[model samples]
Target: MQLVSEFRPKTGDATLDGLLEDAMVRFLSRRPADRQDALEKLWDAFERVKTLEGSNKSVAVPILLGNAALGSDPFRELLTDEFHLLTRVGNNFTIRHHEIGKTPPPSDHARDYLFVRLASVVAVVLRHTGRMA
Candidate 1:
């Protein structure tokens, strides 16, 4: 799974950029735990990236997505679905949290799949929103 040759997202925020960088480095490692940590950092960045313009998540996310979607209703709906689906995955898995009964990725490939999916979404958002070059 080729996530990217270099994962540099110019989100106009240093902390979020650093988090995204760290996640890429950790995700590139061979260890499974590092991959999980990567997911955690990535999801954290994803959550924060939405708030780059405003504080309210509900308001900011839709606006951020609208920026990315660029007046395409179908694409906007797709982005909306992807945002929720990825959020759910992060929440239900052990990658982002370690509460009671969280489930780890089913396998190494599954871990890779999850990482690639979310990372790609993040890249798209940054690109379409003029945050990344």
Candidate 2:
């Protein structure tokens, strides 16, 4: 699977940007034979982007995604539902929950698909937030 060389979203938050870059590095590395590890890292990156403007508050993903500070473009408006769905997918299948034997693990293809989705979301968020020119 092809991976982005860097996950630099540039949300004006240094820590969050660093976290995303780290996650991207892990996802691109070949050491993670188990797709779960890459998914977990990508999930962490997603959560960090979501909470970028929350000041560490326990805000819902939808609320974070809808924040006016992000932008009011039509694309941002359209992304609201997509963000929620991604959150649900992450919660259901990844390490966000301890389902262990209860939930089936994601296949390599599924993991690659999710990675692309997440990369798109992060890129959109950065562009909308005026972080990306």
Candidate 3:
């Protein structure tokens, strides 16, 4: 398990950050085809990371973002796609999936709420990872 603290975001490069976030979003998706497509993006992200000084803390953020994305239940159950970026960051950082909210109400509205909440997390992660927010 990689510690959350170990993952850092690249702070100064706006363009690079956006690319990483886009890659992460694709990787986080719960589809095989999407995962495969995201892998290339992940490679690009890594290239950006390599450009940073080894001492930079922000370099680790991709690992954290990938873990969080892959750890989500839908992504994990597929048992096929793995988060390569997360592994490279180190085993110290671990991504855990938690029920984001209380037991949903028995109505259709509940599902909508859950979707909104999850989407919000994704958005935040993307903005943070991309350095756009």
Q: Which candidate should be chosen as best, given TM-score against the real structure?
A: 1
In model 3, the runs with Cα more than 4 Å from the true position are 1-10, 54-133
Model 2: weakest 10-residue lDDT segment is: 60-69
Taking the tens digit of each residue's C-alpha lDDT, what string does model 1 give over 29-127? Answer: 999889888888988998898797798989999998998998999999999999999888888998778899999888989988988998999998898
Give the alpha carbon lDDT tens digit for every residue of 31-67 in model 3.
Answer: 6555444444544554454344343535654454544
- Model with the higher TM-score, candidate 1 or 2: 1
Ranking by TM-score: 1, 2, 3
The lDDT of model 1 is: 0.87
Which regions of candidate 2 are displaced past 4 Å?
Answer: 1-3, 55-74, 100-104
Q: Whose lDDT is higher: candidate 2's or candidate 3's?
A: 2
Off by over 4 Å in 1: 1-3
